[model samples]
Target chain A: MRRIVTLLLALVCLAACTKSAGSDALVVGTEAAFPPFESVATDGSLEGFDIDLMRAFGAHINREVTFSSRDFSALIPDLQAGRIDAIASGMSRTKERAHVVLFSRPYARVATGVLVSTQRVADAAGLEALEGDDVVIAVQRKTTGEEKAETRFPNAQIRVYDREVDAAAEVAAGRAHALVYDMVSIVNLHAQHPETTRIIDTELGIELYAVALPLGSELAPALDAFLAAETRPGGKVDELLAKWLGDAERFRATEE
Target chain B: MTAQRERLVRGAVVMAIIAALAIVISLAPGEIRWALAWERRDLFLTGLGLTVVISSGAVGIGLILGVIAALFRVSRSVALDQIGRTYVEVVRGTPFLVQLYLWYWCIAQALQLHGLFGPREAAIVGAIGLGVFGGAYIAEVVRGAIESIDRGQWEAARSLGLSHAQALRHVVLPQCARRLLPPLTGEAVSIVKESSLLSIIGVAEITYHAKNLQAREYETWAAFICLAALYLVVTLPLTLLTRRMERRLAGEEALPVARL
Candidate 1:
């Protein structure tokens, strides 16, 4: 018991010590699994669209960039608690999120799509077509995909999986007719599982993905300036997105 | 010269294992991480609590349950015999984690059950899960020890006009105690290891806290490996104590032969 008390007190001291993170380095938060936006690449380096952009943005600001990778869900809470300076996870800058954190100008446009077996993608254009009271839709627990599934297909039975990869697998196995996820995730899914499944057309909940600084960050204005420089008047950011997420449309049009 | 040779061989074996592990941890690419290094102390403390709570809870309750269950096994009635067999078989048949999940998510999640039970959710689940699982194996060990008591001694005690309860309290129970300690010590070690499953239900036990550190810092390997080392530290002493008891009991047996 004395040891537990001592450990608790030590944690309190460590929490106190984290108040100052310094200006020389920027601590960037991201879920390294979300590809095109962020993921650990095949070569074992952290590589993705957001990663390249963040590195460039860090260079522009003359700050050394270091990333803390975690499950996507942890990114927002970490950002809100001031644990990281910014989030580069392909987090859609929702109006609801605007209340919690300041966003850089939209550096990447995002949209949602479905990863379904080719057969199911043939049958449905939207959630309503998928909801047959008996039909199952697999979605990641506590994600926007889950929320939309709940909102749109109220009658559809939902088996909540903890990760997007599992949800896509359910679709590929024909256990679930469809899966809801962001466009980047669907692209990655089809790329990985082209023989079994494919992504479908008609995006849902379209929004802008941005770099989020904490609520009332002194860094937001400067982040906005750099985002505009790269994306505002058509510079290298657009060209890079074209090369990376462009083949995504071909996957979206998958048949048979 | 004989002792020195044993010591030299032991030292070489230990040093070789350590050198191999050092190479693996160093050369494993992104697997080598320092992020969870900060919470190493916190992980140690939580693991200690986790070990003690499960070990003591399992051992303490296992003793009481073991006695009751063992009594049923020894009973003359067929119903009690069947009941004891069923309990032992059921508990022994399942894994500790499946039992833990059933207790934590199913039984503990029922709001009325939680409200009626005095202890907090995690504690109740951990206690019940560890207690029931430990009790099963303990029941068999206890039954074996109790039955091993010489039937002639029991007959002699009864011939002296002592009640069955008195025979148990004075003679049978004492004999059972020495036999039980060695196995009981092993059960305690298993209880400590089994407590790792409690982490899955968010108990803030050792593995749970280590996971929090790993997730926050992205140091999966270091956090878990160090946490495993902490568990070894706690359980190794208990394990040695148990082994010593076995040695002591072995010495007691040699005493009988010497007297003969």
Candidate 2:
């Protein structure tokens, strides 16, 4: 027994000693399912405004940026665990999240909107009209839109989904009364499935999107500085905004 | 090189090596600071509580289903045996995550459509799903334990005028308990570990809370180490209990023999 225990102890020590060799790459976490911001393409590569911006930031810092796609709700936990050095998902700067993570300067602004089946679009008139026990609201889990839906429509039954597209599909199938999400995502979904869904004109609220870093992280100052320089007039932020959302004047007007 | 001194030296060396590793990890820059988990202890406690609840509920359900499936497996009827075999085969063949989604997304969605339940019931569905999955494996453990007994034991009970059920309950099962304890404990541990998957469907178990804390604090190493320690608290006691039960069942044979 003693010999076996000694052998196991030696093996454990060897494992622990080998694991301490670390790397210099900056790991960034994102949910690559949210489009016009970040999404997976046909070739299984991550692409979007956030991906481009993060790659640019990585180049500026002279560190290789590695992206890890995870569920949006999981991004903060991954960041906290040091699984990822930063979050470049289209996360909004909210008071609740700010308590846990440090947010860089707002890179862009987005409006929250409701998407409903065309038949219910007239009934959905606005956020106020959708608040009732009979209404079922679908929102992506851990997103600003879900938080807003929960607080604003307290009576409505809220269903949280893992993906934005899933939430939109619930409304498209008429199983859900509406989906509360960012305007750009809802608009894009509506454009793709025009016959099935429509975006309600009622504006939930405007939110500023920013990158999230660990609280008191050593990288926080450097990230904030980079973001400040990038968001300046005629900087990388403008170029990205033009490339991704410029086709629509409304989206361009919302850019920070 | 006395045996007693040799054992003491071995124990001391293991402890010294462990202490060295602890120091190295603590001194390393950017290493996980375990103290960070202390700040979010309440969150972890909540997660631990949910994990225990889900695991216990699933294990209890699994044990009951296991007995039924085992009975079918050992029964004389071909149809019943086939039913048991198919259930165990199919459930054991598929991935657990797929089964969890089937229960949470498909079955739960259908339940909601019929107004039988709502989305919040996914945790209950998840527990039951885990139980059903575990039952398939547990069924095999039980069948193996029962079959491992000598054939003459059943014949001896029959000669004493006991019915099949009475023979099983009073004669066969009592003996099988000793053989079954170790593997049953192993199954229990697996069920507890698998409960972490419940987090994907939003069960808010230990892994979920760990992720939440990590996301909130960005202290990845601290959160995971704490998570591992919490799981150990559940599994370690079970392992010790199994050993104790095994020794107790072994009777005087388990006692150390006197050196001649």
Candidate 3:
């Protein structure tokens, strides 16, 4: 009799596991490498600028949010694998990416800049002049810098690294000529390198970071509606942007 | 001279095209953020602690549990023998993660075990998951090591007027332990690496740290590569130790001594 009861329970559980999961809790996927965007703190709490912003965005969408952290490059693959419903990393919506995944309207737009060493800036007039045979530029893998470099300095030697921090670190260590990244990270990185790298006015391209969804997801329309409603002047998104961006300035800007 | 110059120019242009393509394929905008995180010391320490503590604790507990089951099967008792067989077979048939998930997430929570443990109860869940999963393989190791002891050795110990307990403690156990060490160490290494899976329940081991770094840095590949290297750094010592022990055990006599 006891054996019979146990067998029946096991059968029920095996059946239950295969059922489609509903999105009661928003299963937001993120690659938590970007500080001030999404990062796991010392206390095991996920905190950052994007996290704060996402919390506000979730409220605007009338959804309770939860996060699954994965490798940054795996976000798109994870989303396609049905492991996550949406991606909230600092993903730039580009023409190539649009073919693979649907992106929401931009919540935050970051400017692009080139950070060169203090020593290099004294001699260099412009990027075109710096394109000598010895010039090597560092940038992150699978990001807009690769595309921008193609468009801007096709002949310039580009060195690719696994992450932005490493590439930027290379520049500070005098390993690369300069690093290309968004203005926010460039400004933040300067704190460590102490003006060893400086920004150049020579433009590459501007990318708008947006929330991404699996292509043809039913949830996309609903999220788009929320973004559209919130982006209106003095609406909830503006307030959230102010609050999150303001909060980040206090906590995120300091490492020590 | 003109032809050679033309060829040199064409060769230089080809190399430049290759370099340009390489930049596009490999370089991106966000690699530094993840790389810096991979180099962070605090996260590495946290992950190291969780991996060792969970794996060692699980293996220690599993050793005790597996021995008890293995002995029960060898003992001339019907009910205990059935229990051992059932446990070994069932454990072998199921995947470890499934068992772990069931133990920590579904069954324990349903039993309201979190209140019985503490507020941040995932650690207990992870340890217990480790214990249960570790026990399955440990049972097989115990049975094999014990059974490998010669029948003559058992009889010889008995003929010398030694108590059954004394024979096991003094004679059989030392040999079995020495023989089991390699598998046991392998199991330990496995436990440490496998603890990465417990991050699903929020253990914050190295893999979790890597993922967190990847999410923020958006440099997923480097973080994961660093994580892989970290795990190797942790396990490679055990690998060498196991190799040394295996060599020590290689040139011995039959049954309990060593063979294939």
Identify the leading candidate in terms of DockQ.
Answer: 3
lDDT of each: 0.70, 0.78, 0.71
- Considering the two chains of model 1, state its CAPRI-style docking category: incorrect
Q: Estimate candidate 2's alpha-carbon lDDT, on a 0 to 1 scale.
A: 0.78
Off by over 4 Å in 2: A1-22, A121-124, A247-256, B1-149, B153-260
lDDT of 3 by residue, A1-256 (tens): 5974686476345434422333366778876666667777745667765676667767877888888765566577556645567888778888988888999877666667788766655545567755775777888777787667656766778888756777887787677877887766777777656757666777665667788899998887777777676666565555655664543222221111
Q: What's the best-to-worst order under DockQ? A: 3, 1, 2
| TM-score, ranked from best to worst | 3, 1, 2
Please write out the lDDT profile of model 1 over residues A110-222, one tens digit for every residue.
67787777656454455457768877889876567777778777898887875465577678777888888887778767776676676767677665778888988888878
TM-score of 3: 0.56
**Clash-forming residue pairs, model 1:** none
Q: Candidate 3 residues B1-260, lDDT tens each? A: 69999999999998999799658646644334544653666777778777887777687668777888877776668998899888888877897778876876567667665334432345566776777777777888988898898887878888999877678767777778888989988888888877888765555677777766654444555676678878988899999999998988885543363332
lDDT digits (tens) for residues A1-256 of candidate 2: 5975786477446544433433467778887667778864433356889999999988988988877666788788656645568899889999999999998888888899888876665654666668889899999999999999999899999999887766776787688888989988888877755777777887889988999999988877777788787676677888898898874334432443
The TM-scores, one per candidate, come to: 0.54, 0.53, 0.56
| lDDT at B28, model 2 | 39
Candidate 2 scores a chain A TM-score of 0.88
